[model samples]
Target: MTKVDFYLLTSHQPQIRERFACKLTEKAYRLGHRVHIQVEDQSQAQKMDDLLWTFRQGSFVPHALMDTEGAAETPVLIGYEGEPGAGMELLINLCREVPQFFSHFPRVAEIIDQDENNRHAGRQRYRDYRDQGCSLETHQLSI
Candidate 1:
């Protein structure tokens, strides 16, 4: 069974979610995990790719867009559609709906900021995971 972690952020700002995603991705990469970040669409995927490069000063997270060449070789990938690729151990979902391929990964991270819709969707996803018999955890992130 996969393990699901919900990151509850105090702010409703969308950028905060992206920043947290970057931080999580960086941490996972440093720990030698291959990460797949599922965004809502191509635009968000591109935004995530860009944010990962500059989210924090003097920090770097090697990543690529899913469609780009050499992406399979990178430790992190950003995508809105299709498979997460072989051997990707961690998934960070930035979409409102639960990803169909989420269970394929050993660990899934769902970032939920303080937006009303986000909270609703996160609750639904939490229930869905529980019903699926997956282990679940939640972390409240301040700031």
Candidate 2:
């Protein structure tokens, strides 16, 4: 069974995003699950690298999204930079979209802003996953 979680970011601080990513990585690691993250650009990917190193060592995992070009198979698909993919145990959304990507992953989570506009988008994604028979949880993080 897959689980879904959504977190609302209180601020747009870079540290906050990194912190959440760390938490996400730790969660995945503790569960003994492999992770594949997708980002919009090299910069965001770099940011994730910094945070992920605390949990993972050695050469960074291949840029699966870039290398796979949405063709490869994965247990988790993250939509940060471009089109989001499903078929993952967990999907983490780092942006403020409606999270169409959640439909693909069995477990989906989004880090969204506290503002009304972004808040609804993240919550809607959570509900969509839940409606699809996924366990969903939401968190609010301070900046």
Q: Compared with the true structure, what per-residue lDDT tens digits does model 1 show for residues 1-143?
A: 99999999998665999999999999999999999999999999889988998999988899999989999899999999898778999999999888988889999999999888889999999998899889999999897
Error of 1 at 131 (Å): 1.1
Indicate the TM-score of model 2: 0.57
Runs of candidate 1 with Cα error greater than 4 angstroms are none
Q: List the residue pairs that clash in candidate 1.
A: none
> For each candidate, what TM-score against the reference?
0.96, 0.57
* RMSD versus native structure for model 2: 4.9
Lowest-scoring 10 consecutive residues by lDDT in candidate 2? Answer: 58-67
Off by over 4 Å in 2: 1-3, 9-13, 54-87, 98-100, 113-136, 141-143
Alpha-carbon local distance difference test for all models: 0.92, 0.56
How good is model 1 by TM-score? 0.96
